[model samples]
Target: MKIEGIVLIGIGAFMAVVSVGYWFWSGEPSGTAMLIGAVLLGLLPGGYYYWWAKRMKPRPEDRPDATTREGAGVIGSFPHGSIWPLVFGAGAFLFGLALAFGWWFLPPALGLMLVAATGVTTQSRRGGAI
Candidate 1:
């Protein structure tokens, strides 16, 4: 994480410097905006990882005498198959289709999207498969 953060910061800084140089030479506002966005994008995750590494407890890898077996275990649980994605996809498709077809299709598509989003969000609370 620390290495990744450093790399991201470097990339962002490089982008910003190049963009600023380009803007000065060509006077393009688009490049300036892009550089600003790039800097923010790089800073957000870089800062997050730097903060996270500092705040987190030292892991097995951080210890000089730690064994490989010390890090072997279930890291976390993940959801398998779920129907909510399909529902959401259908709603999205309908919403897009409505843009070219008719405005009347918006209500049902939006409703399905909302319902599916709510169901996915609340599935863990209900102790159901996601």
Candidate 2:
């Protein structure tokens, strides 16, 4: 986590410096905005990982002397299949359509998202399809 954080920060910082130079050269607000966004793309995750790295005990991968066994733990069971993702995609598609076409699609879009959220939550809690 620490290493990941450092790398991300470096990436963000490098982009930021370049963005400053580009801003001065081109004097284009749009270009500066996009470059700053790139800076944020790195800084956000980097800051999160670095914060966690500081809070928790060192992870096995971070230690030079650590072995693979040091990181041993039970792996979690993943969901085999679920329809929630399709439901979400459908909702998102409708939402986009609403934004592009008209406000009438908003209701169905919101409803589908609601249904998906309920189904996924129920499935996780009951360990079965909803």
Candidate 3:
């Protein structure tokens, strides 16, 4: 999370700096306005990182053995052993590619994939072998 915050701040600061440079080079009101907007937005992530890093602390009750400790509900709930995720991801990619490339066969292919995925998911839910 801290790394994410830093990355956000870095991206925002980069946009602000680039906008400022563009404003000076192009002498455009839009660029100057964008610079101000980017800077304001950039401050948000930076401030969030500072506040979170300083304010957050691990309490005694937050230990791993605590019943309410992080991710307690996740234990033994489900094993990370599903192949459906890969199938769904492939279907999504195909769908997106079809949408982008305007292929004639894409729509029907995507629909078939969706139906197959639904069937597989139902079977899994019924405790049948995938």
Candidate 2 to native Cα RMSD, angstroms: 3.6
lDDT of 1 at 62: 66
Q: TM-scores of the models, in the given order? A: 0.82, 0.73, 0.41
lDDT of 1 by residue, 1-130 (tens): 5666787888778877887888899898987888889888887888787778788866787677889899998765467767888999999999999999999889989999999999788875665444
Candidate-wise lDDT, in order: 0.82, 0.91, 0.70
Candidate 1 collision pairs: none
Write the number of the candidate with greater lDDT, choosing between 1 and 2.
Answer: 2
| Candidate structures ordered by TM-score, highest first | 1, 2, 3
Which residue runs of candidate 3 sit more than 4 Å off their true CA positions?
1-11, 27-45, 58-79, 96-104, 108-130
The per-residue C-alpha lDDT of model 1 at residue 116 equals 93
Clashing pairs in 2: none
Lowest lDDT 10-mer window, candidate 2?
A: 121-130
Order of quality (lDDT): 2, 1, 3
Best prediction by lDDT: 2
TM-score of 1: 0.82
Q: What is the C-alpha RMSD of each candidate to the true structure, in Å?
A: 2.9, 3.6, 7.5
Best by TM-score: 1
**Candidate 2, residue 124: lDDT:** 80
The clash numbers for all candidates, in the given order, read 0, 0, 0
